[model samples]
Target: MILLDEAARHLKASLKDMDTVVLTPRLSQVYAGINGHADLLVHKLDDSTLAVAAECTDFFKNLGLHYNVMPIEGIASPYPGHVQLNIAVFGKWVIHNMKVTPEPVRAFYERQGYHFIHVAQGYTKCNLVVGRRSLITSDVGIYRTLKDIAPILLVESEHVALKGFNYGFLGGASGLINDTLVFAGSLERHPSYARIVKFLDRQGESWTQLQGPLVDVGTLIQI
Candidate 1:
């Protein structure tokens, strides 16, 4: 009732485990069936972490990650309990050097089962951390919230929308190397974005049919 009303009210909630279980029944079944298909040991990486001597997700990818890395995961939304914190980096702190972030951030990730390990860089590195051998995530925006980082502002590269999580971060790029941890969202909601719709009428990975596209679960998520 609430979800239907929200949709009718023009407000979609940020997805959660509850949403996953409720909405994507097939995906849940798929995950359950593939749960024993070799655990995917993964990692998250970025330039700031590289400069700071912290290992990036590329390191894990080159080592052959247990699973494929999807760079963008969640959608970007305002950080909680703030009026204008999400875009603050653009106006004022884009180039400023900061010694520390709000304490709530560290606490937030810690609550998400992430073990904080500070990287020591000759006093010129941003604070960052990695996952604890489980769900690999470093997006501070959606660390505990449903909001992923904005995808439009990411570095130029071809990106794919993974089937499971949208509003989250993945570590590596498609070819050059592992993608950096960045906020990625609004891939499907964009008019210019087109992905490989592999399904019934949508024959190949890349095709366009004005009539009607595949409406299966996978196609629904990507196209």
Candidate 2:
């Protein structure tokens, strides 16, 4: 079965074997108040322990994911919810490259055995991994850092959606399932559409687009 968040519910029937989860509206409101993005409130730390806002505790439990409630330390809290816990786990390292990250979150990945790579882009999930050592991102800083390390296709960020914001992140706009990279919307309108298709083709990965506007739904993890 495919696991998706409520924002993607419109694609449910089309996506075979679908299972969906929705975070409480209160959490959505809080996220909007901060970064205007829900991804800032959720993270799949690993197979277990899906880190999410406290309000989603029961929702995740019902989905059978071991929920780790992220404490809301207010907007000015030490941690920048927009980037602090929003890390990308790929290749050899958990690529965050941010100057500061919560120690507890950092420690969690350390125990998982991934070294942290310094990249200026805090929105790691926006850089979707098409294969084992390949990714697609619109973040130039991340592209420059991992270019020599992996096959990364740098794209423009104009078409992605962030709702109240100007644009959303690419990594957060799509997810990798068993053999296909699923995008929340079609890529025909993206400037990098052709390049993205070519990159995915070279990586031996297929992609599917759901019908709708391309919105960032956070990273979908298999629980």
Candidate 3:
């Protein structure tokens, strides 16, 4: 089920827990660095990511984690589904754009215990992992809606990178492992890095900055 062994190696090394991992094919030719963006390409009711998920599922299952693949289709036409599965899940909340999320995936989330909340913007990539009870985002709508129930920080999006787009998102450049939050780029360059760090520190959470620009690689999923 492995498409590129070298890329898988890099992915394994980037993860804090390597006992079992699910690797996806990369979209970027520069596979040496952490290119998680290339790996996640989910859509609504499509089989676009099925093959990769199947392979990764097998890979993880062999490691005794009882992993299974649920390949989701990416969006169609002009826009790319680079962050299709980028919805944020914590406790009973599933924060995302209900209009774009795949029905199967949403149903799966419900079966596993999650409630959906619709937001106008589909840029769920700007999320910063702060456990289920808290989250960090640049989208004003989300911040306003979830702020009362969950601890949240609204950071400006001018500093993030999206390559083809205007800017990258916070969630796309972030990943959660155990209690550590890893960012694709250094927070030092972010205008609100200090405030962002302070927010996490107060929650007893620590962050690790990965070497590279703040590219939106989509959410690094653990399954």
Candidate 4:
């Protein structure tokens, strides 16, 4: 099953063939628009385990996936507080601002023998787009931090839409479905369209460009 934000309902037609769950504004702690962002509400620790927020436990109960309900009430609206589960996992390493990460989430990853890569950015998952063997980001801190460890693609963050922010991120606008990268909006509207395509081509990756301007509806989380 795939989890998507309720705000992204317009893209449902394109993805009608797949089973998807739309996240509604149930958590009051964070901004309403972002209440259902999977990266903020749940973290897929591994193939079987998921670290989910307390408020969202009911949503995944019938999904037949093993999940741990976090101790916190919900994700707070403030910067670091809202990013508790917003970590990016690439292969064996997980990246995030370690200082603000929830203790339980951190401990779970550590127990799984995963290495933690620290970055200054709290919204690591939002700012990063992970491929099978490579990574992409617009945040310089994240790019600089992972450049040495992996093949990282640096792109401009302009033109991506977010309800309450200046701009959304590339990671939030796209998700990987098997080997095909699915984008919520058109890639041609972005300044780095050509570069992005070339980078994907080099990695032997194909992409599906949905119609409309790019908007960050968190990420399309497949469970």
Candidate 5:
């Protein structure tokens, strides 16, 4: 199953063969365009477990995946509140502002012995595009923080669109489905398109660019 933003419903035709769960603006606190972002609403604890917001539990209940409803009141529209579940989980390192992350999510990863990298940026997952062998991001703080620890590509943030915001993020616009990287829209319009293609080539990854200009529909959560 894959979780996608309802705003990108037009792309469903391109992904007609896949089982998709479209996230609508059910949560009042988050803005309309971002309310359905899987990175902000869902946390994958393990292969069979997922930590999700209370309002989203019903969506995953029948999918055969065990889910833990976050033990908090609804997410608020403030900076940290909306980012509670937006943690970036890499192979061995999990990056986010641990102080704001929900306890249930943190405890599970801690018990698994994963290294936690704390950054001032709360929306770590939205700012990151996790590839098989490397990482790509537009947030300078994230790039500097993980540069020494991982193979990372820092690209310009220009041209990525997000409604009601100055710009969107690369991570929010794309996701990796095994060896194939899936993008919400076209990368050819991006300023650093060539650099991004080169980075993907180096990682030995293929990609699927859907349609229209690149927009942040949040990371496509594939399970």
Candidate 6:
């Protein structure tokens, strides 16, 4: 609770009553700042940087959150079971679930993608909600922030804040936040997007790192 508490220390607003909030994929990193506003926020925590993960390992714990290995475990029933979606795409971070790690992936393009979406550049789009709305977003960090900000406000507002405002909102990026927050666009662009959703739903398991109102991580794996 420390991380959540500290993040909420400066803001006096009741998270449950928030109307809306804008979040970026950078919300995944600990250094990225998150506002206690918005009734709902989608977020991320599935950083692929082993070095950064080691450095920021305790960051989430310090905030009262913990990170786990979420092992890929082996292939399950469907083999392609949970689609392996990435939040990075075409060397940019517009947000998509269709992209994969890419075979023989290009270094320059990938780097550009991160740069465009990284928190420092300010181009991440994802979050979470937990007050009163059904709580929907495409990012994991934002989702966590929503969890942190919730309980401080009313529940009514949080319930419907994310009902059905998301549609035709897909760009490019298979990263966790993008996969979780994506509404619709073209699974063809990133088949992994649909695959992941299918896999998660089939497995009946959900993770805080990739749960959005429109797209649930559980469904990603299940579908």
**Segments of candidate 5 deviating more than 4 angstroms:** 18-21, 64-74
lDDT of 5 by residue, 94-131 (tens): 89988898887778888999999998888898889887
Question: What lDDT does each candidate get?
Answer: 0.20, 0.63, 0.57, 0.80, 0.80, 0.25
* Per-residue alpha-carbon lDDT of candidate 4 for residues 162-201, written as tens digits (9 for 90 to 100): 8877889989888776556788799999999999999988
**RMSD (Å) of each candidate, 1 decimal:** 17.3, 3.4, 5.8, 1.8, 1.9, 17.1
Worst 10 residues of 1 by lDDT: 214-223
- 1-223 in candidate 3: lDDT tens per residue? 2221233234445553423445544434222233334234432222122322222344333545333446554432233344455466666777777876767778877776777877766656445554534588887888888888788899987687765567767776676654467776778889988998888878767678766566565555443
RMSD of 1: 17.3
TM-score of candidate 6 against the unseen true structure = 0.21
Query: For residues 100-209, could you state the per-residue lDDT of candidate 2 as single tens digits?
Result: 56666677777878777788766676555445546888888888888887778999876777566677777877776665677877788788889988888887777788
Model 6: how far residue 34 lies from native, Å: 7.7
Quote the positional error of residue 206 for candidate 3 in Å.
Answer: 2.7
- Rank by lDDT, highest first: 4, 5, 2, 3, 6, 1
Model 2 ranges off by over 4 Å: 1-8, 16-38, 66-79, 127-133
Which scores better on TM-score, 4 or 6? 4
Better of 1 and 4 by lDDT: 4
Can you tell me which runs of candidate 4 are displaced by over 4 Å? Answer: 64-74
Candidate order, TM-score descending = 4, 5, 2, 3, 6, 1
